[model samples]
Target: MMWGSSEEYKAMFVEETNFYNRIILGWFLPPMMWENLPHFFQTWLRNYIGGVFLYLVSGFLWCFVIYYWKRNLYIPKDCIPTRKAMLMQICVAMKAMPWYTLLPTFSEYVIESGGTRCFPRINDIGVPAYVGYLLIYLLIVEFGIYWAHRELHDIKPLYKYLHSIHHIYNKQNTLSPFAGLAFHPLDGILQAIPHFFALFVVPIHFTTHIALIFLEALWTANIHDCIHGKIWPIMGAGYHTIHHTTYRHNYGHYTLLMDWMFGTLRDPTVDNDEPKKVC
Candidate 1:
């Protein structure tokens, strides 16, 4: 909470010292304030401002490389995506900004506390802390994201209005990551729980938390976007592309373990049963 119209956010981000982390918890601050605002305000402001921030920073960098460096920007021809369309996706995601920010914070905290030290949040959590706090935090974040994502699908009315826009991308690309944020306002709130709950539930360090957030965003954005064929010869982005090809298959967000355990994984080698056009 850093910029709510209420006294709450202002005090934390602007009024308080070390406003970013101490008050709002670093990366977690912007989304929280965006979420807490009145729904109407959140919709317009969050999409326009937040979306532009994300798109411009990323787009400008990519455009720079493409234009100046003369490197081929790998966009799938079939994807038929445009800069404008991708930017619009940012507005689509604005609805889910709050939860997107908040829940991941909790997940990061738990992971940094040594939950899933196996994955390791770089060196920030430290080897010792990771070993001590790995399992519980990892399980909590995994289950939280899995079910939250699943619920978004199973709940029909909710999915039709909120989650459907994400599925609209027939072919995934840099724009693919923006797909998930098009949730209903209510769906956005639901997604925020994992982080808020983790705040009180888990004991975590700040650096570990920041590392976790970066990892989450990186993994997610990479899987959904940059990985076109496969990072590795045998296995890589193809695994996630299969999930996009058949939305029902890949529900787990972080690790591939959950989908394996639940038997929900769709093998990249297998032909899709009935591939639907991107809605």
Candidate 2:
């Protein structure tokens, strides 16, 4: 099995003292406090509490950056949500918290067969192999999310009943980082299926798994933040803002690869030349 040892697996979840890793991990659990707990308790806290914390912090950071630091520089003034809509988005996200917490536990059960290799540590495999696994995992998630997201729009019943809740923020001004998870519970679950499924099909390192989860949170916020611009082929707020404006296009999560391949990719640059349309 490409997955490493139990000891190596456990090491990835343990608290670290390095400043960079500590800062990243600290966003989930306080080093001075939670790190002192027993390894079992620490690991449990990191998985459950940390997962929720990452979600909240990622949303808040994007909100803070756009609302405070960048002001109207990066994000268009028209695209900024009203305080009421922002508050409502937060309320909807809070309702999804239980689902977020349960996701990890559900994933554990799904991938737990025999000695389970879903949580390999960094040293368990060579760097090249580790990077390759991450790339594969991302491709798998992208393919899954593209079709699921596209169908969420194509299927009228699913769109009206489930996906439509997300479209409430369809226009730019109503969009926010919190709006990313403001989806109906069923809609959120469908988009997340690939993450869990990958655990069974791929030899993912536990650290990479956690990192991907964090990136998903960050990217979700980035897409909804309304900061217009393309990061090359990688979809950003510009790409997603267009999706909100024109519901029929740009359904891929992180990249336009699937959208381009499937003919769903609309040219966002044309809209960029036009005057800003704020909600």
Q: Which candidate leads the pack in TM-score?
A: 2
Lowest lDDT sum, 10 consecutive residues, model 2, at: 12-21
Off by over 4 Å in 2: 1-48, 109-119, 271-275
| Model 2, span 182-247: residue lDDT tens | 877778878888887777677787656656765676678778987766677888777787888788
Local distance difference test, each candidate:
0.50, 0.71
Report the Cα lDDT for candidate 2: 0.71
TM-scores, all candidates, are: 0.60, 0.80
Across 24-137, the per-residue lDDT of candidate 1 in tens digits comes to: 333435556654664334333432344335544654454444334643445434543466666676675554565455444344333333332223223545767665664566
